[model samples]
Target: MTILVVILALLVGLVGGVLGGQSRGRASRAVLDDSLQREAQAQAERVRSEAEAQGRELRAEALRVREEASRLYQEAEVRQGQAAQQREQAMADAARERADAERERADALRERGETVRERETLKQDRQDTKRERDELKREIERLNRRAEQLDARGEKLDAVEEKLEAHEKRLSEEGTALQERVRSAELKLYEVAALTPEQAKEQILSKLDSELEDEKAIRVRAMQERASADAKRHARHVIAQAIQRSASETSAALSVSVVPIPSDAMKGRIIGREGRNIRAFESLTGVDLIIDDTPEAVILSSFNPVRREVAKHVLEALVQDGRIHPSRIEEMVHKAQDDMKGFIHTQGEEAASSSGVLGVKPGLVQLLGRMYFRSSYGQNVLKHSVQVAHLTGIMAAELGLDVSLARRAGLMHDVGKSIDREIEGTHVDIGVSLGKRFGEPLEVIDAIAHHHDPENGETLYSVLVAAADAISAARPGARREELESYIKRLENLEHIAVSFPGVQSAYAVQAGREVRVLVQPDKVSDAQATLLAREIASRVEQDMEYPGQVQVTVVRESRAVEIAK
Candidate 1:
């Protein structure tokens, strides 16, 4: 029994030790679990703090973006308002320009209408004057017939007077035979009565001288009346009307072209290194490049207007492109020449249309267009030609002739002048050749050749062209004359007037359009002074070549001057 109790105590002790070790292990595990929970809570607090900081930063950035967007919107609104204002201003400017253009158009139309009215009135006046002239011519014829009848009656009266005188002579002879006896007896009685026969003969001669003075007074009165009537019936008014009917503008054109540069610096560029560029330009264009002290300007001079014009275009293009060299100059010059040709064609078409001419050949049109660059005595050839065409048409209409043919002839009349410098011939001859070369009608060619030679103008169309040319060239300020030529013409006029008899002094006045002469009163009577004026005018017309007409006025005054003594 003692051994069994010892073994059971040992087992109990061993089991108790096992239970103590289990309790200690369970307490350590619980402490470890609490430490772990605390660590996890701390980590969660750190994560939340970081997340709040990120949210604040995001809000701040969003506010900045919103402000920037607002500022940009404000700027865009301002820009839009400015754009709208500019557009309104532009629209206003356009409207004003359109209104101005319309006003100009209206004014032009009004002027055209007024011109038409004036032309019609002139035509009517011319017709009326022509009728009056015809009537006056009839009156002159009647006067001439009456004068011839009076001459016949005077001859009959002279014959009757001669017969009466013969009868009186026979009677006187018979009376003398009878009176001889009476005279012998009377003489004897007179001697006795102390009377003389010479006193009776002297008394009879005094009575005859008084009768001759009375007959001279009657003839002077009749001649004066006839001269006054003839002066009133003259045709000077018709020529004045024609001159007034066609009036045109006068403008001067020069054969020089001015090219504008951007600045003074460009002058050097054009001159180039050692002036090679300018030399090239001049050689290519056949024009002189005159670069003087004038600022930003160059002068191109050439006798040939076409060359000057082409040079002007080339210079302008080179200046604009800013590339000036030999190769570039050659290129530009060629281009300009081509452009000039095209421009000439267009100008010809415009002229043809404006002048109311149609069916002109293309080659002829080109030639006509070239006339735009040509000038005559400061007058543009093209413009003068156009004016001539219109005037010819008007005169042709009045004469009941072919208006179109007249206009065509007139327009082509001076075409030869355009190329006369190029070819070796007179303008008239060149024009005739050109017309014939172009297959123009014979009448047209004849008109061209005889425009200056009115006597050779066979067709009425040719005559009209001649008249139109004169009207155009002789209009006031239509052409320019050299100072030398003008002085020479005036001198010629005075010289012609002085060559006439009874002219004490001659003066050319009114720009050589008229001449006045002072005549000796004793040498030229009142009736003779009238004849002197007509004679002087005739001499002037025959001896002088002048534009328009010249007036010859002869002055004669019987002073009877006694100084009021």
Candidate 2:
């Protein structure tokens, strides 16, 4: 509300100021108009006065005009005189100007005439220049035509010369060849083989055949060679296929079980615990009863697989008889031990008879029977030996090796394993020493020593033994229970062998018994491959601990061929 009042007051003040200014201007304008009117009146009055004064002057001028007319007449007379003099002078000057103009026109006409002549001369020069240009054009055209004709002739000559040169070169080559043939004919004629034309021809044919000198004949020979190679290849393929088809012996799992009993009561108690019962049982059977199960059941463990089996039966018998006592246990145990021995002997005889392993001593047979108690890498050594023997026989027969030697080597390879726990050195060394001392063949001894050392190259039989052992051990799931450290050692054996330069790939085959390394052909030379194989084998020996030995094989191959069409 206060602002509104202030605005109203300002508007009122502005309106009043505008009205006062407009009124003052109007009053000033009215006063100015009155003053202008007075000034205009004064101007009019002054103008009237001036007009009167001008009228008076006009009257005076009229009088003066009369006088002036007289004076002008006189002056006109004098001016006429002076004008006459000036006209005369002007006429003279005009005459001179006309003369000068005429002179300039004459000079200009003279110069134009000279210029016209010069222009004609220049036109003549232009015509000459045009004629010279035409003549030069004709000359150039003629010269160009002549040059073309010369070029054509030169080209023809050059072609002829090139033909002659080519012909001469061909003749020279033919002549040289003819001269060489002549020299050769002269030389051949001077040779010891004096010959007529027919004889020479025949001798040449004979020489071609003898020396394999003719390319066509060589081609025929190559064909024959290829055919022969193909036949050999086919034979090899057939043999390989047949071998694949043939039945092969596989590694056998050999495990032993030792059963324990509860008490001596069970033992003869196996015999029925009485003198009468003991006598009856001893008379009935031959078996040993161990009444002591110190901490456990009756010890029913033995090396002889058969004896152990029989002992099992005898114990079963005594248990069935239900006799109980220390004496009876003794009786039953004795009978059981005896019966078990007989069973073992029979089994040995049977094994020998079946496998054609004759001349085996009974004591040795018993010792062999004890193998039932022994195990190597979860395998019963005796059974493994038997499997190895069979595999060796089959392989030897197929490969045309010594079948009997291979089988014997395989069977005895692990013989030292039986006492290895009790003896020092590797089983191979021990078995070799044992075989040598026992008067076995040198071959057998060597085979035993190098069975695990194929690179030893001591004997072929050793290689066969090693191969058989591998075949037995490499079958699926065979030796699966090997110690983790042993398996890792075998893996490391192959890893070390393959770690060498140039090997592209490596496989630990034959239950880690062999490392087959494939080397880059471009990188590995044949000599280098051989050295690498030897080095890998050495590295396996020095860096790895493994059962048996590892065979390192490095293979490198290169091929070259040319294709013609």
Candidate 3:
């Protein structure tokens, strides 16, 4: 306003000086000044009115947001109440359906009063007591099977809930990202709005800022509450895009390293004179050389991939050199052992480079290289680690965290898997020790220790690493659980179900995918049985690690029989 008035006064003064005397020019100047002042005051008043109107609108919006929140809260409460009532009604209806069965079991049930009242009959009934006990035991075994079925059904429900949660989480992440974009755009618009007479605009904006402070605080609190409640699901959401972006072609192949030769004659050469050359190579490399009937290919079998790899290298070199004598086999085996070190080192370097993680120790790098030959659940460990690193880095970048640290953590998260077969402790424990030995950051070590259990993690990076690891493992064709592990999971499922109170027995069927739990009907009420199924499913989710899904089922039964003589 001051600048505008100054320019206008300069123009009026020049015009008045040219057209009028000094006195007349002074009077014109005074009139122009008064009119200009009045106009400026009127403009200021209009601006003030506009600012006040905007403030009112903002206040109205805040009120509206609060009202909407309240409405949502009330609606959620109503729905929960309705759901509770429906569950109760369902429970009541089920109880009524089981009324006859319950009545039949009443006399046999533990009742001191009935026992005393039927004391005279009890002596006569003693003869059939043993038969009744055997029958009761069989009934219990049958009910246990029923419980397992219910447990399986509950597991399916849990799987459905997991999918729904991931979908909801994806939507939530999209919404949050969109909100960030909108906020940035708003800031740019605000900058543009302040271009003309910045002081005036700033004055209004300052008032607006002051007014919004309370609202911003309220919103921040609400967002924090939501974020805390959905931390794990949100973690998954952060890496969803990363999973879609990942490209991994590595697959878990059979453990046996097949060495191909030029022809069947080459196999005879590998066998050596009376097996001396072959025996020498096996002794040095600790790998079995199998001259199989499979055309021109021979099999190199060893439980240790490193040893098997060395044997494969040595055998191939001997075949190429056309020297399969005992002396030649020993020399070739020694050279192959030396070459194995450089090969694994190169592999480790390539893995680090692929993962975009630098400054790794030589020892750690070698460990990482070992992972190329190591696998778990039929998935390549080094490749899985690299994929995890990509995913973790992406999630960290999305959340505006330390991307390099996150990537490093992800790349080394499974380093223990490389030596876990030879080590004494779990992969997680070994990974943590390796991280510390390699001078990794505390965050990296923490993430390595807790990537499989995010709830125990202390840092956001742990959550990111955990999410990334799960995605890498669970991706299509990423990993295949071996038959032994599959069977073990089934056994664990049955064990877990049977361990629960009132469960007579449990059987894991459907190829380890489902469990049938039979519960004693007298001990477990219908409602309790339902809750037990859910509990068993939850326990399964927490205690076990299995691909795809496991369903748990619980079955309860009560029957009455009458005989006429």
Candidate 4:
């Protein structure tokens, strides 16, 4: 730009000089014009060189800009490639996730297949059981036929015995007639011989008396034999008929009930907030909640069957609801208690219907239902009652007594057991009271009061009930005391474990097969805990008797907790 300006100024100067020379000397004018032309040409050459350098500089700047743009384009392409790689990586990640999902699905399907196979195995086992039952039925039928043959033979023997009794009676009659004729002849001889009348009279009287005693003795002996035969035959028939009319299956009850959980992790949830939930549940339900290392299971233990049942329901509900808190525990406990009433009613009704003892008052039925939870010597009281009812009914029908009255008496024989723990009396006393309160017949009440003592039975029906009760109670598997001993042993184990030094708590689980003890970490070291377990186990072995073996576990734990606010 500067060079162009300078060249334009030189043109203007040359034009001015030419105008002035025209008015001056020619030689001066020529010199000035030459000088001016040379200056103009130099200025033009300098302008051209400067412009070319400027052009070169502009071209260099453009080239630099183009190079910068090329670098930017390269960077953009690299970034695009990086983005594509990232996309590929993400796709790979997605594929891996999909693969993991497929694997999980496959595992689930495999587990389902195994479950199906197990289900089929269970079905097959049931079929095998059915087959065994069928075989038992056939055997029973064969025994029945054999019994019929024995009965026929017994009848024949009975007929023969009757005939012999009649023959003996006729023989006694002929002997009596012979003795009378002898007495008459003796009297005549006494008169013909002219013996003293007083002496003959005394001799004849003594002889006749002796002869009469002998005849009476013979008749009494024959009568006793016939009576014995008759009594034995009748008892056998009555017992056989009663037993044949009844069938039952039952097992002893246990003190603890196990509730299944979704997972072991739920143990922590159930023992919430420093075990407030568990403590609340135990207090509300009157049950001991034994949460141990037993996988996916917890035990609710109480000597009271109803309380244990309620605790079981509460725990199951809490687990299914997945909300375990003290308040929720109390709520569930109340709900379970309410449910228990319905359950008890249903059980009572079923017992009545099954035992064929109708017209039981609702209140009486409720009491009967309570007996469902009550057990005597490890026998379920309600079930025992039903079996007794069946036996009594059958026997009463055969013995020409009131069948319904007998059944009712038998079914209610143990009704007092329902409240035996509540009221202050023996079951017999409570039962008699309840029977009267419910308007039971005199025979029924008498049976309930004295089923344990048949000698006190007031009527034939009461006697039959007592007999039936004896039969039902005597049946194999109907009663057991092992349950009580089993629970006692477990309690004894816990007691022993808790007696140890530094032990905080002890729980007997695995049906008294194991005892878990928690010890204070500050008082008991890890080594001490091990020794404590051994000591507890030794104590249990020494002080208690249990089936199988009892495992003792002592846990000493130290926990650190902090609150972040």
Candidate 5:
């Protein structure tokens, strides 16, 4: 039984084995399939991943391309903008060049046209001149013929005049005899009717006096005409000669002199020990010592003319002596100042002789000569006075006025300037007093006084002197220093004006003679502007150096805004 069971079991085992083997095979196959599927899935997943990666790469490349394109577009836009700006600049340059070229062309054309017109005008003028010349020639010929005819008629009239004179004398004798015979017959009845000779003579003399007075007016007019013509001719000749002459530019001598040194070692000696030498100079001579920027020159300044002269001489002497010290400076200054009085007198005399004004009072001449130390408009006052005197004398002689008086008055007009610093009156009044004290006549004194003040002069001569003085002063380039303070004065005026609350800005125009203020519209009303303008004008008058009245203007503005669609 065991054997039979074993056989059956073996068969069952074999079948089971076969079935198990098939199952194993099937499971192995399943395992293999699963592995294949997994591998395939992995491969599919890798393929999908690769595909996705490729797509992503494509997308990235596309994005990079888009970015690059955008960058290129941006670069193009920048280049376009640059080109546009360059083009605009080029266009502007071209337009400016074109405008300049057109203006030049137009100016050239205008100049050509002006030249043409001028040439045409000259041609017309020449034609007119030729026509006038022809007419003059014709008139001259007629005058010559008329002169010859007048000569012939004069000879004939002379013969007739002699014959008529003889005839009249014979007739007068016969008539006289006839009248005597008739008068003898009628004398008995008419002797008492005849008047005396004295009565007839008196009446005739009275008529003659009236006629002489009437003729005096004609003579005066004729004399005036003749004098005017003579003056004009003389003036033209003198002015022409004067203008043709070469004039020396006479520069006034400076009060200061610059001394040059060989080396800088002299500066120490000039300063002396402890600045004593400079102190001595300042104390004795009263001149401020300015030592700067100069190789070896020391500047001397003083308002006192005499003191300045003394200091100059002392410094020169000290420089020459080579013994520069405080004691030496004091000694030299004393000697120099002592010698200055004689110098003043000699200089005054020399100036008078050079000016051809003799017989002047020595004191007055000295005063007059001191004007050399002063200047007006870069011209020495003494020299200018001489020139004015000469001019006045020339004009006076031409006008038949008193030339000597005019010359003396003109020369002494500003004499008081010498002592003006010491005086307490106007230079004009002081000058007049000085002139009168110096034996000047009433006319001369009046001239000196009334030259700048014309209200008091009663004489024609005084009027003429005043006119000449003004002419000399008012000539071009005749005054000193057109003051810059005038500008500040104008600015101050404007500042004072704008100090008001409602005023926006102020401008001083016409050299401070007019003030124009701009006012805020909301702050200042129209009526207020007028009142403010008047008030500003009044204020300027009170605080200004203006010769004439000031005109004030106030401006206000309002603006309206609108939008248009």
Candidate 6:
């Protein structure tokens, strides 16, 4: 039984061992499977990662290729545009060539026609000369024939004269005897009437004086009427022509320059910390920057326009760059100053060129450029000078003077205004001094000196400049004055005319440009009226400070009335 039980135990133990082995095998297999699954998952993740990276690379390559294609397309478009522009330019060139050819042909034709006309005129003139020569010969022949006939008639007349002389002698004797009888009769009548020769001569002289006085009065009245009519017709025609020939536009200028800001916040930036930025800017640029209640605006003020301009540009740069500091401000100010010099020179060159004034000294041109920022009575001095130049040139052309010289004088006329603030004398004096220093011509210097108040004898060029200056200043909207000043000028003009002895009344007309004086006909003769007008004009010129010229017109009338009773 023990053997059998041991056998059973061995069998059971063997079975249990077998069961354990199987379980061990199963656990090892399960472990192997789990390890294989994990390896497979790791391999799959490696493949997925490789695939994702490849996909990303491919996408990147595709994007690069697309960008390259787009770049090529843009380049092509640019090339196409360039080609089109080139083609258009070529077409324009062709058109211009054609136009030039046509113009040349037309000019040739005109020249040919002119030559033909000249030949024809020459032939006609020769023919006229020949005809005149023949007519003169014929006239000489006729005069000779008349002289011969007169000689024959003189021979015939000599015989007839002998007989007529004998008859005339008898007639003379009879007349003398008749005159003696008449004289004797007159003497007897004078004795009987108790009259002497002296009294008769005195009466005759008085009658003659009365008749001569009447005739003199008639002639003087007729002469005055005719002269006045002619003077009016001629004066109107000349003045109208001068005015129509010159026309220009006027622009107003101000002393202050304005810079625009993007917003109110920029004001604080411009002010900077403790106002150091602004203070530095002003000190460097010599301009006052006024940041006030004015929204989005900054005002730059300085008597020196160049400094003001520099400050304006510097401020604009600081505001735009969003950097406001002392160092940056200084840098900008220096840059602005450099740029301003170039700009000012360019402006001067342009002004000189546009005014048709050539050969100007560079220094004078620079001085003239300063007028660009100057204002006189709200009128830009530069613009006014340009306008004067144009007007002067026009008038000079009409009057057959030197247009270039006139234009030069007009352009430089106001150059002194630019430096007047720095100089110690009047603009005229400074201008004259500058002109002399710069070796300007005598005429230009004279014009600069005497444009405002011409002395007793001013050059024609000076007069032209004065006239042009007046025309430019006196045009509508060209210049403006304070209301009080304008009114005072007008009142003064009228008062001057009224102060004359024979002036019954005076009126200031045409915005103080003209004064009309009415004189009593009895008190002022026609000649006296003319003198009075001149005297009034002279007085106004001496006493008043006015723009443009004043016209003095004196009126005198005579009336004759008859009563039909």
Off by over 4 Å in 1: 1-239, 482-565
Residue 336's lDDT in candidate 3 = 89
Angstrom error at residue 384, model 1: 1.4
Where model 4 places Cα greater than 4 Å from the true spot, the runs are 1-227, 481-565
Question: For candidate 4, lDDT tens digit of each residue in 431-507?
Answer: 89988898988888888877888787777776787777766765544666444565667778888888877999999
Better of 2 and 3 by TM-score: 3
* Superposition TM-score, candidate 6 onto the true structure: 0.48
Whole-model lDDT values for every prediction: 0.83, 0.68, 0.84, 0.85, 0.73, 0.83
Per-model TM-score, in order, reads 0.47, 0.35, 0.45, 0.46, 0.41, 0.48
Cα displacement (angstroms), candidate 4, residue 79, comes to 99
Ranking of all predicted structures according to lDDT, beginning with the best and ending with the worst: 4, 3, 1, 6, 5, 2
Candidate 6: the clashing residue pairs are none
Query: What is the RMSD, in Å, between candidate 6 and the native fold over all Cα?
Result: 33.8
Clashes of 6: 0
lDDT of 5 by residue, 1-565 (tens): 3344454465556556655665768855654555655665575566566667777887899999999999999999999999999999999999999999999999999999999999999999999999999999999999999999999999999999999999999999999999998878666444464645576568779999999998998999979977985786575553323222212234444556555554667777877789988887788888787787776566777766667778878877877778988778877877886687667677667766654567888888778767767665556667666666666666666677887777777677767776787879977888888987888878778877887766778655566566555545433234444345666677888888998889999998865657889999999999999899878876875677543345788999988999999
Q: Please, what are the lDDT tens digits per residue for candidate 3 over residues 427-491? A: 99999998888789999999999998999999988889988888887665565654456567788
TM-score of 2: 0.35
In terms of lDDT, model 4 sits at 0.85
lDDT of 5: 0.73
Name the candidate that leads on lDDT. 4
What's the lDDT of the predicted structure labeled candidate 6? 0.83
Please identify model 5 stretches exceeding 4 Å from their true place.
1-257, 474-565
